[model samples]
Target: MPLAKDRNTLRRDGVQFSDPVAADTLIFAGALVCLDASGNAVPGATSTTLKARGVAQEQVDNTGGAAGDLSVESRRGVFQFANSTSTDQITRADIGSECYIVDDQTVAKTSATNTRSVAGVIRDVDSNGVWVEI
Candidate 1:
């Protein structure tokens, strides 16, 4: 099928999102975040089952609440995070390659034997940290 005439399309910036936080989850502002198996926001960590969402926009404490009791605002874009050490460290050659979540603020070169989930692609690496296109 094809458009018969004119049509309107909805558009968005595609960089930000607001999703419900997982129960007993405490997401800190500026920390890397991910969605768990149930699609609830949680701090990014070395887990093979999590999907990297984005950086948490603000702190949201759901320690005393159930799932969906609160929401978290996250922004998706390129961000810098700490690089893993030793065998897990990211190097300049790893640019444009995929990285894994080491923690809320760190990424590694590999998935640590599938014990970690994909963080994002490496855009650049510097003395400070790895710039990830999440």
Candidate 2:
């Protein structure tokens, strides 16, 4: 007549131990929270503001879906506009093209116009033109 061995045991604090236990087993003592790069909780970061690193540029998309136009070039990075007090000023030279942050806005060119709106950050300004980050 041999005594039976207890295969599993429970500690006083609610931890469980068993025979032939795994070495790599992870035990969760309590709840865990996740955070973002800013060290803020991910869930609470929904409203977090992202600072723009460079100048602001408005995207101009053609509305008519035409294959060729200045607006198309603007959207494709060929041409970009700088922020102005009333409107976006187009410039070929990089002078006075300091990067600025701006909110999104929509503009109607015309009834048959095929231009759309886009927002992006400025990457660089040169004598040729200003580059935007889409």
Candidate 3:
């Protein structure tokens, strides 16, 4: 599946932090995350938790080994996360647009001129998913 007119490319998604932390369990890339009491990366839990810590950047489709090898395997620092958008908020996404944590693993757009803390920002989006600068 190659076209002569097209080539591989990389995009500047985020400015990575100097250090990385391990995921508390199996986590996919682009997952909104929070810090466990031990300061490890854990999957964020629901929109109302207000535990908007950071984003995850690990992706493992299948881990067919014993004892859940995926746990503590994905180590990532403060890097920007990119993934699907909340259907209710996709339309409001634009570059530099402020976004909110709508769920454990997604982001949404905030109402204009409202008072709320911003979770991240809309870096990019398309038919597949969203690119959040978190």
Q: Each candidate's lDDT (Cα)? A: 0.95, 0.27, 0.49
Looking at candidate 1, what is the lDDT of residue 1?
96
Q: CA lDDT of 100 in candidate 1? A: 97
lDDT of 3 by residue, 41-87 (tens): 45554333343455544553333433333443332333343343345
**Candidates in order: C-alpha RMSD to true structure:** 1.5, 23.6, 11.9
Best by TM-score: 1
**Per-prediction TM-score:** 0.93, 0.19, 0.45
Candidate 2 local lDDT, 32-103, one digit each (tens): 111223332111111224221122122223334322231111112222433333334434342433333232
How many angstroms is residue 98 displaced in model 1 relative to the true structure, after the best TM-score fit? 0.2
Instruction: Write down the worst ten-residue block by lDDT for model 2.
Output: 25-34
Better of 1 and 2 by TM-score: 1
lDDT, model 1, position 59: 97
Query: What does candidate 3 score in Cα RMSD to the true structure?
Result: 11.9
Candidate 1 regions exceeding 4 Å error are 1-8
